[model samples]
Target: MAVLKEKKLGAELRSVLEAAFPGQEARYFLPMSIGNAPEHADEGAALILEGRKTLTSSPLWDYLDGTIPFVGALGVLLDGAGQPRGVVETTCVEIMPFRAVTEDMVRAYGEGERTLEWWQSVIGNLYRTSAIRHGATFTEDTPLIWEWFRVVRRL
Candidate 1:
């Protein structure tokens, strides 16, 4: 038997957005959650809900060429249990090397020790491991896509 996953989130992409912003339209949206694990996902999503985390970063190499998120991009934030929790709109996007990630940005991540040192050691390791897992190489100078978003609505 096939295992079922992520049942009855009770909202589709369009419905979720519409509920949040009546008459608003988005050309596309990417369903997203914060972490690779259930605990981390819950923690990160909570931060977003609390208005603590407005910034997030991803390896530039993670996106297909020309597919990096642009300003005004819509995303649905999900909790660890795979429940849709909120909608976010990208307000800004910037590129920076991993080592150059600023203190403010890490604070906006609002997780862990919430420091640059913690990010360099902990979040950095996560990024490095992901690169390796994907058969890609990463370095301190690896570019990261830093996105600043606003919580558009809580679902």
Candidate 2:
């Protein structure tokens, strides 16, 4: 229950995140919250709050800390109090076949038409199911990771 305020610079956002999780590291940056506007893109970053390998025999062999690699992350900017304030997120992960399904799906997206449909229909369905039931491992509340996102250099 924190208030994630929008600032004029990436440094503001970075400072907020770094303060919240001192030891965590910001890894990647991407465009976010693009409301169908091809040119409107915002800077986004992710930090692995905590990570550990899942010791389960399911399709997800390891939990990479924070949202699963394929699943779109649930992002919330934290406030000084370490509470979620601002939020940014996508409905689903962009990558597929994930670890459970065949890795070929990863290549299919760019390979051919059949590959795309197979990835969208068959493989996507499988992954959605796996996520819903979470057949792999790890108990409830032990979410892969707590993620955050923000738009930077935006007017």
Best by lDDT: 1
Write model 1 residue lDDT over 25-109, tens digit each, in one string: 6433566677787777788788888998888888855665447667987777888787788888889989988888778878887
User: Against the true structure, what is every candidate's RMSD?
Assistant: 5.4, 15.3
Per-candidate Cα lDDT values, in order, are 0.73, 0.30
Q: For candidate 2, write residues 33-150 as lDDT tens digits.
A: 2111212111111121111111101133324332242223323333233333343332333322233433342242221143434644553454355556645533332222222222
Error of 1 at 29 (Å): 2.2
Cα RMSD of predicted structure 1? 5.4
User: Which residue pairs show backbone clashes in model 2?
Assistant: 66-145, 70-93, 71-93, 72-92, 72-93
* Off by more than 4 A, model 2: 1-9, 27-31, 34-155
TM-score of each: 0.85, 0.23
lDDT for model 1 comes to: 0.73
